[model samples]
Target: MIHRLQNISELIEVSSRMGSDINLIQATGGNTSIKIDGYMIVKASGKHLANAFSENIFVETNPQDYYYNKNGDIKIINPKKSSIREGDLKPSIECNFHALLPKKIILHSHPIEIMAHTMLNSFHSKADLALKGMNWKYINYAKPGEALAMEIAKSMKVDNNIYILANHGLIVCADTVKEAERLQSNVINKLKLNRRVLKDCELESLENIVESIPDAYLPNNKIIHTLGSDEWSLELARKSAYSPDHAVFCGIYPLIIKDINQDWKRLMQGHTYAIIEGKGVILFENSGKYLEDMLLAQAEVFARIPVEESVTTLSINQCKDLVNWEAEKYRKKMLEKLVK
Candidate 1:
């Protein structure tokens, strides 16, 4: 059994570095973990990786105490006994999956390059070709928590160290934290695709809309313009969100606005941002920096999707499942805290 105290320093260092890389993680979207003895120390729910070292965001728990139902619901054998730490901070909802894996260190991230491929309708075929040399495992869509963990458990093998969650993210594991990071880097290098150059468009129209909108409607009461002026971004905004990150953070799809006079709240439903024609994207008053990163990631993912292949987006039911998840709500709350 490894001593948690002995490894805390390295764990903190690795977590912070991984979290700070916007190319690999956005907001509190990804999770990291270290296992010693029967306990798993994981990034607490709602904790950002960039701050994983500075803050007390790790939770110690006995992952064996959790079980899953046929329907994917999680059942903790005993909450009080399961925890090895004192505080309200909760371990990542993915704690069970981390526990089930055989590796000593694990890192999960939502890299845009990886997402760009996973979002494709031909994910199985395309990924098969892209990740030719690696022993990678893929999970069909499973709601986070028991269902997702259960899916991973089924396919995880002793030899395979990389996993791709459909429309979700990537996972890399190794005996050491640095090795895990290396493996993650290698996976990204292998799957990386060239970004598309956006066609030019005029943004003078967006300036007018920004001036007309009340400060109350903008995030931080500041009007932030993004993506809409680029021709590629405009077409992407019109399409449906195909991945879990896009659906959960950006919404089922971006709200396209042609007129500033429309009821902002009514049209936005519960989405975080909107796309205006000939203008650009507009964020809501409550939108946080974490959200802004997600929006940018969406732009990158959309730009990276190859022009020849058509991508399939998540369906309405799939989108509903993600947006309504309680765990995701907590992450959103943490993101909101960051902007304040």
Candidate 2:
């Protein structure tokens, strides 16, 4: 008979293991949770998985009553301590999505290879076809938190072990934490094999691309929009190495806007970044900066892997599939707008 998972420690260990195994969560791009008794054990916000131990993992409130603010941050009502308030420690911004899974354990991550496929518009159907026998659901890109959680809840019926967040990442759920970990591994391994098949078809080149920008483009008040002038290097790295396919979808990089006002203006002006296959892309808006940073970091890590260690590249057909998928996405958006 299956044993019930006992305490917070067990949940913490399981959550930590999932974070370690799936290359999706680096530093802290991903979060994990497990239900015990009436409480949910979730990874503490701003805590890195590599260093996350038991004690500091704050337990603020129950999963059922979690709330989302206007900015999409999660707020929990803590009956225990008034100062130890719901929104006090600020749970993972993605906590609501984690809370919605019917399983005891939920894992989410931004795995690079999987993300490479996810960022492409065409890959979801291809991925669905690829994982034909397994039970899963896919939800299109929505700003994270309440909106995304609501969309997933609407789309999913059966308690599938995995959910693919379109243009984002993967979510795995299982009866036990160990089972969830295993499922996550199996999914990653399959995606890795798919990536290898694509990589083997042809090698994309990155020869003779300009690696440096002129001094004029260097960080200045005009250019340093959101991250401040000090983060210029960080911004540059983000633009340079963000995923190639993401460039096609989200633009080369997001524009760095300071506040909502600037963001609104930029969106109105239609000034967005685009991706190039080998070369890096730039970031524009701060909202997408976290994703850009994560992709850039992953690219850097991949760069260190020797050429022989690299898997096969994606094919033109695969690329075209992504483009077609994006077109459909736009069409759907237009239809929605018309309906509105």
Q: Which candidate has the top score in lDDT?
A: 1
Which stretches in model 1 have alpha-carbon errors above 4 Å? 1-6, 67-85, 216-227, 264-271, 336-340
Q: C-alpha displacement of 277 in model 1, angstroms?
A: 2.0
Candidate 2's residue-wise lDDT over 1-340, tens digit each?
A: 0132235565667556645653566544567777767566666555545444543444444666653334443343332222223343455556676665667778787676665555444565567777778777777665455566777766755457788775467888888767887888778666653322112101122112212211111111111222222232333324322332343334444444333223334353564332232233333343232344444434433432233432223344443444455333442343244335
Going through the candidates in the order shown, the clash numbers are 3, 24
TM-score of each: 0.86, 0.55
Q: In order, what lDDT does every prediction score?
A: 0.73, 0.49
lDDT of 1 by residue, 80-162 (tens): 34655537677777777787777888888988888888877777776788788888998887776767777887777888999
Off by over 4 Å in 2: 1-6, 67-88, 193-340
